[model samples]
Target: MSKEYNVAILGATGAVGTRMIQQLEQSTIPVKSLKLLASSRSAGKQLQFKGQPITVEEATPDSFAGIDLVLSSAGGSVSKKLLPEAVKRGAVCVDNTSAFRMEPDVPLVVPEVNEAALKNHHGIVANPNCSTIQMVVALEPIRKAFGLKQVIVSTYQAASGAGQSALNELKQEAQDYLDGKDIQDDAEILPTKGDKKHYPLAFNLLPQIDVFEDNGYTHEEWKMIHETKKIMLGDMNAKYIKVTATCVRVPVPIAHGETVYFTVDDPSVTVDQLREALKGAPGVVLQDNPAHQVYPQPLNAVGKRDTFVGRLRADEENPGSFNMWVVADNLLKGAAWNTVENAECLVKDNLI
Candidate 1:
């Protein structure tokens, strides 16, 4: 029999956390035990795993005792505080937060794009942002076939990217709007829960995702820009890849859609060539059929783990440039599934 490792899930009650549970249940890692860690308010809750009830515990510095693997999607602050504790207790952690992503020792990974990075982890691995995950999954195959030069992306992000409350708020706001009630007056989450200003996301689009930084880009946009380079090119080579993004919060409840325009280093790369590159790419489903009007959409992508890519075309204005549409479940491939995948890689590589 293969070695069975003890696994613990940090933030086991949140949106991504719950999905992490689902993904783990479907993973190949041999599990000797499963531990669910949440905050005190949610401590007594019992969540089902493989038809068994696992009691949620309040996470502390000592929650990681005897755990061999840790999958974390707790907020960044919680991760910043608790992940090191988990690491100190001898567990390999795959974190689904921004806290440690840019750290010198941490590997910010998308398994399809940079699975080998997991071998370099110093106890913790970082999962890229949801939007960045889908883009890179689609782009990596093309990059490998041709050569990537630059990327400019505009995202149609779903409400779930903001979290469960925001998803609930989107539903309420949509209903309020449909019933001719005031949405703006009760709006509090979309754009960002931490930001001062709030806006209705129903039947409308907010041009911002996270709070703005000094550079005039929202933090979410900044993540897509920097995280892409890190995942595609490593810290030393990341500066060579140019990436720019505009992230927006849309009314959709799950999955994220991106319109990406990229210039390949090889000027002769054709649209059909790009389509062929992605058709068999790992974790990528090629849905590009312009004649049949078949392409990736958020509704089709929801609840699925694969990143869907379509709308392949060459830029008429720029000979070496190409464009594509990418979509995936922001909560799954973007967060939970990626986190679980990293853990599987760690096990496969004997890094854990």
Candidate 2:
């Protein structure tokens, strides 16, 4: 029998953090002990693991004791403070925030795209943004089958990506509107928690996510662009991956969908080639066939673990341009599952 490892889950109360608990229950990694850590406010809350109840504790620098693998989904600041401490105590951390994603030394990974990056980690590995995760998972297969040159993406993301409070706001506001009552604004956390203004997400689409940057693209958009490169290209030099994205938050509660337009270096590549490539790709499901009126949907992608892709067609105006739609559970395959997969890989390869 192999040795069991102790694992830690930071931010054990947040949406992605809670899903980390669920996924770990189903993980193949042998866990000798599980530690649930959060803010002091969340301490003493009961969380279940493998049919047993575990109390949450406030995470501090010393929380990494005896931890073999640590999966952290706490906000960026918490990671900025605790990640190094965890690593100093010899815990391998898989962080789900942007804090370490772009670090020259940190590996930004999606297991399906670049699990190998996990091996070179000096105790910390990063997971890409939820929006970029699905897009790259779908795009990697095509990138491998036919060399890709440039990509343009527009995201239709769900409110749950913001957090549980945003979801509650949407539901309450919808109920108030349906009851013919004045829909009071609880816009404390909608578009972004730290932003100056809160906009009503119910019956509305917010084009701004993660605030605006100097380049006119929101930070979320910049995340997709930079994280895509950091994930796909890693430290390797390429002229450029040539990516641009516009991220928007829609009223949906779960899953994220993307409309992507891409050009391949191989001009001979056709829609048929791309379909065949994805049909055989790991972590990808091809649901195309316009004749049957079949395609991927956010509802279908929700609660599942695969990146769904469909609506494949050649861009009529551009000879080598192609369009495709991709969807995935932003909190699952995009966040929790991917983080769990990284931890599992660490154990499988005996790195943890």
TM-score of every model?
0.98, 0.97
Question: Per-residue lDDT of 1-352 in model 1, one digit per residue for the tens?
Answer: 7899999999999999999999999999998999999999999999999999999999998999999999998899999999999999999999999999999899998989899889999999999889999999999998898989899999999999999999998999889999999788868887798888889898899998888999899999899988888888886247667899999889999999999999998998888888888888999999988899999999999899999998888899898898889999999999999999999999999999
Candidate 2 overall Cα lDDT vs. reference?
0.90
Candidate 1: 10-residue stretch with minimal lDDT: 232-241
Q: Which lDDT tens digits does candidate 2 get at residues 188-226?
A: 787899888888888778999898999899999989888
Candidate 2, number of clashes: 0
| CA lDDT, every model vs. true structure | 0.92, 0.90
